[model samples]
Target: MQAIIFANRTGNELAPLEQYYCSALLPVGNKAVIEYTLEDIVTSGITKVKIIISSQAQEIEQLLGDGERWGLDIDYFLSKPEEKTAAVLDRLSLSMTDSIIIVRGDIFRSPCIANFIDFSKQFSNEFVQAKMANQNACMLLLPAALSYLDGIDWPLTHDYDSNSVVTLILHGRCHMIDSFQSYMNANLNLARNDIPSLTPMERSFTSANPEQDFYVGAKTHTGDLSLQNAWGIIGENCRIDPNVVMKNAIIIGNDTLIDKGSTLENCLILPHTYVGEGLEVNNSILCKKLLISLNTEGHIEIDDQALIGPSEHQASTSSTDRNLSTRFFILMLLIASLPFCPLLAFYALIRVMFFKLETKPLIQEMINDNLGRSLVTYSFNVPTRLLSLLPQLFLVVTGQLALFGAPAQIRYATGRNKQRLGVFGPVQLLLDEDAPEEERMLLMLEFDNTHTSTKYLSLLWRSLRIPRLLGAERKKQNMTH
Candidate 1:
């Protein structure tokens, strides 16, 4: 028997999800939507199949290459948006004796195809439609009836006429998910074991507690949370805080972090998402870029990444350690600052005498101490700005401030706006003080959250341009005043 899986559904209803992945690739549990259909076909003893895909075809092709993993010979065909479903099938050109099975990609079902085939052989119908609650489940087509569907429009509804249409009522699980609410419902049902198991990819990282209906993927860390009566599913490489309370939730996708003291109930937290601490997320889908509230049937795209941002892996301590590169860069700045250091010291001495210069605890030092205590501080003067920053080079050399890192913050800086101390930073060099406060804060948070070696080099280059930036800032300030 041959099979044709139509994965050509344009996931307009999926909205923000379609922006990232095709609906066929949407995670239903630990697996994609198409995986369940493939498993059904494989178990039915069909070894050859053709997948018709349109959006993100390359990604899907890469994901299920040749289908050897499932012991099946699979071929992929690209379908156009204008092409009818019947036209797509006509291109295959099956023989008159061939019995083919056609499965829709967007739906999730675990039907006994073998039994359907047996029924089809015994029955005299040319087209057999499987129905669940009076809705189309799937269809079986014989070769003799193939010519009648040539050039017909897609989405063969119940109104489609056939010489002999036999309806097979589905007794088991069948769910058609065309919207976000439907998708969420499907996942919740699956988590509650309302339907048959959707076979997950064979990976060593997956673990399932059948008793508690809890499924966890690999490389995931869960803190001390009670899972006695709750059904929870966590994806790979995720971090769950110890104070979290989760009940009947499906947290799929990788590298997600649930902050401390958060309560999640029947929520779908997408991959690469960061849930801030102490927020109650219930009946919602939290993608890295969007927050979908199932309760209100509405969604909002998240522009500020700090609130519900993308997942970021913490840099290893060794990578962020004061290495030779940092030391060399600090040394270069120190040498350059030598010419102005004595002058700045005299200026600072005079300012101290007049009570203009004051000692402030380094922000980095305060963060390290975690005591949240700091001393007095000298304000940056317009004419002596570069000279004043020159003193920080000594701190850079002493391994106190990184040459290129997050901007320095006061001891009272807390919440999302808190930043580490650096001698010079991307924000001070790139953003004018006149920039929107929210934009500046978000930018700094993003910089601190990202882990890249190139940022250090970029900061070094920006340091050279600092005098120009400072001059511009002063000019802007003077103009404003």
Candidate 2:
């Protein structure tokens, strides 16, 4: 039987994580979601397969190329966004006499397809709908005589009524992973040895503790780490710190590092991530720059490179230069502010004399000369706001701040000290100061994560517009009062 697999379905349900890869390419255990479907088809004696794909078609092509690894004759066809599954089949012009099996690329199942084929042949029916629970497992057996029905505008559901009799096959082992929770659960099941063993692929590294149910991929290093009541799967070339502890976790991709004293439980850490020291990551998915919570289905982008960042090998030199340039720009601003020093002093004296304003010394954490340390500074009240800020500009000259970075508050300094504290930044210039704290934090984190030298001109423009923006905001606030 020939197989027709629709691999183009958009993965909108798995947002954030879907931003990086197609749904079919999502890693389950040692293999991608689509690989399981392919293995099932190949095992069931289907040698000729047609894969219909869209979006990340090239990525899928590069992965399954010619299908030689599975000893199948594979052909790929690109499908349009507006086209339905029926239209895709018609466009491919599959032979009328070919006994065809249709499968959805995103579904995972360990089905004995030969049984389904045999069951379908006894009825001489046009279609056989295989139902696992209430959902269509995306598996359909179409008799050769009914190939002309491929153009029918029907959804791939059990609700279809073909000209011939429809046979139903109930298979409970099939799973449809349309969300982050389902995806994580599937992998967790695999790690826990709850599911049947998948076909093992070749590996470079041996399991540190073969006694435990674990799958360690090629070139991975356990480094004296121990698993407890968990089945761990570490991808190729990952470094697990000796002090780290894991229970029922799956780490995919390559070149990841689990830092010292970190504990992970039922978490999925994507490739090239660095889990910082002493972090307790539980029931979450850590993709590049994003942390998705499995329980709440909420996600956050971690812009702090030191906490959970790209691998060291992927760190670009341009990022280093951009940071250095920010420091230089801050130093220039401090020099320009020197003339206003006397005005600041006079204003401070007026505030103290009339407003009874008292300046309090504050010890603030700062990134000085590329090192993290505390700096002694004076706090300013509302009446002396601008005046008190002048003395802090010296921090710019001393390499403690960036002209266009985060606020200098210690609470905002929790992440990696790589980002320079600044007087004004994209978050401060664009977002209302009265906005919810969580919203503001998310925006700032996103800004820090995506900002680069390419955004230098934009940052400069925003800096120039800050005075006008703040003036308008102040006017608006006064009107509200």
Candidate 3:
């Protein structure tokens, strides 16, 4: 008989992290999250397995790929967010068999095969539905009276009280882990040290000697090391920088980096991070959007998803008010006094010797065109112009000024105010000039001070206090532009 493994993972509450790991890398002890469910399906001696994925589709693709790892001939089906339940099942039934085992990916399970086999065999009717005691544990038993479900509409009137026929509710077990905290607790109980010696679920696919393929996926670095589990899949796209040390950690997903001279122990590092050099990290799940530290002695929900920025500006910003305020004040002071610093003196000497600060010849020639017009030059010696840039350079180095932003132009006395001492140069200033007077002043100030750094910091701060500040402002700007 043929069996179809139906896996559905969709979570709205798990917004940021779910966008990456999804159902792919939930590790119980040394077992990958998807591995446990897949193992249950294939080991039940099912010939064909159909694994479906919702969000984190990329992660599902990377880890499972073509499903050659599962030993069974695996097929995949995708569903749109707007697609309804009936549509999902209809697509699956078109080319597949009637006997189907639907598994939820976000749910993890213990090493149990008998329970699932019983559900499939006894309930091998037109439809079978599985339920956990709650939603935090593996699926133990399901109602097998789905044959009667074929003719009935799944959506019924409010007055109809339908009772399920076969209900097996285990007293002590749950069906799913709804949050990251529960997931971490489940991992602590399931991972074992003897895993490398045992065959992993993926290895069950290889036709070669299974004993040779017994391997574990664990995080490794070239530096001094301390690892809890000596085996596990170090995702192919992960960057294990040199001089980094790791112990008892599993990494899932891609576009992640563990920077140099860092130590990680019993943690999950999700994708896209610098991991900051020379840090002591332990017992945490570093999702790009949130950091879940299972090592905490008490139950603390770190639901700060705002740490992960929306779109491409994730890395270049910080929202912590204390940090932002400190950086701004310190950078402002440093820049204001930087022109006279000793570093500028050394560079000024070089500039004078190399003639780099000499006014361009084109500017000298342009003086004729400005005969009647006011020609203003902040006349400074070659050495002085070189030194004049020191303040801005200091601001940039101090993390106040962005690498590239509109340079604050000196207000030229000419009626043509080409040079102004505001953050927004010509482009933004011109836009602001067209706005209503009161609104223009307010917006101009906002636009000027809203440097690349400020733009990111402001959005991050707003994302926490307000719902859609960054996305809304960005959309508005795009529309106007």
Candidate 4:
């Protein structure tokens, strides 16, 4: 039977991981993640497969070109995300009469296809899905013919029996790793499960030195080194350095070097990178272009494109504690004085009658509990008019304080030491591994705002809730992160 798999790689739902690696190239076992799923389909006697890809189609094409290796007739379809699923089925329906199976490329499944095929044979014009509930994987059959004009959403409440038609196979535990910690955790789990012990392509990619437990991709090279389960997918025409010790790792695409005495453990090194001598990378993922340290969660999504280019060429060399200098102190006095002109008259008029006014201290304790010190501190008996203005001036002068940052920090907040200056306001709370991306971007942008007036002004406008152009941009960035 022919299966038209709708393999769109644009998985925005997975977040930042989608920003870096495509689903097809995400390393799992001794091969890319999608390879395992494809093998299962081919083994189930589905000979003809059509793959749909958006960005990284070539990588899949290179691996499964003409599909002779797997004895399946394979073809590829490339299109924008919006034009993907429907477009492939529309083109396929014109020629093929056999049943089709549509599956997202990123999902990993096995030992469940036999049931799927049995279920699909029951319906002549139905869609079958490999559904997993808890540890049980079953095939769900649905009687829905191919109609590109109207997309159908399978009703969740539709009753089903062993013989009744059902819909897609949805896994109860299938999750896409979208962050650094999650990615790391997945690799760690796989490593703990002895994924590395699996043999590399026996006849295809192998090193001349024949060190044990080393993984090298097709037409790739690994120099003399004693390695164990070090996953390296060296593309065609790629070279490796000798004397490199890599363990529990993955390398993708092309052109990289592991300089002598470099040890990479439980990491992902992407293409076009050169690791210097005596480097130790553990539980990290490098895009050859960018380096990322994954947290305990096992997902790493480093913004590699931003790490490149002339605009942001340098790495984050500044210390985490580093922030805008005290040099911006001069701007403080000027800002604090601006609102004083009209405030003076208002204060005098109020002082004429109400003498019992016990003014509150303008300099409240900072979110971090740094006492007496503030971006700007005000004493008791400060004019009512000046009270409101002082806080705004304080935000402007400090340059570190944002007009609106995180929810205000509470007393004795732990991890406050990690706080950095932000464009809009100070993040009262400490950053955790699972901290949201908006918080990270805010901290990163703030730390980079070093005495640059242009950046400061831009941040100030962002804090002010500027209309249209800037506001829309802030919202978009917030939603994306």
Against the true structure, what is each candidate's TM-score? 0.61, 0.59, 0.43, 0.45
Candidate RMSDs in order: 14.3, 14.0, 17.7, 15.3
lDDT of each: 0.65, 0.66, 0.44, 0.48
Q: Per-residue lDDT tens digits of candidate 3, residues 1-481?
A: 3443334555433444554444445554444577766766666676576655555443454556556767767667766632333466667654343444444444665434446556547655423333344332223222232333232121211121225444333332332555666665554333322322223322111112222211223442222223222223343335566566655434433445666677776665554444655766677766554555565533223333333311122343464555467657657766676555655556555656577655431111112121233222222122222223334434344443343333333222222222223222322223221333444333434444444756645533443454433334656987999
Q: What is the lDDT of candidate 4?
A: 0.48
Worst 10 residues of 4 by lDDT: 148-157
Ranking by TM-score: 1, 2, 4, 3
Better of 1 and 3 by TM-score: 1
Cα lDDT tens digits, model 2, 1-481, are: 6988878866777887776667788877757889888887887888999988885775677678789989999998988732476678777777756678777776666555667777778766455655565555566666533543432222333355544546465654556677887887677666555565453342323344554455677777775443344556677778887787776555556678878898888789887678887888998899867889989999999897667876763444898787677667767876887786666656556656687655422313333333446565443332323334556666666666655567654243222344566755555455544555555565565565563776756755665555335446656988999
Candidate that scores best on TM-score: 1
Per-residue lDDT of 94 in model 3: 45
As a whole number from 0 to 100, the lDDT of residue 167 in candidate 3 is 37
List ranges where model 1 is wrong by over 4 Å: 144-156, 159-164, 197-212, 227-229, 313-481
Question: Which regions in candidate 3 have their CA more than 4 angstroms from the true location?
Answer: 6-8, 24-32, 56-65, 82-85, 93-97, 119-164, 168-177, 192-219, 222-266, 271-273, 280-283, 288-481
lDDT ranking, best first: 2, 1, 4, 3
Model 3 TM-score on a 0 to 1 scale: 0.43
How many angstroms is residue 226 displaced in model 3 relative to the true structure, after the best TM-score fit? 6.2
For model 1, how does the per-residue alpha-carbon lDDT over 341-377 read when each residue is reduced to its tens digit?
5566566556565765454221123333222534222
lDDT of 4 by residue, 236-288 (tens): 33445566676655443345556567776766655555566577777766654
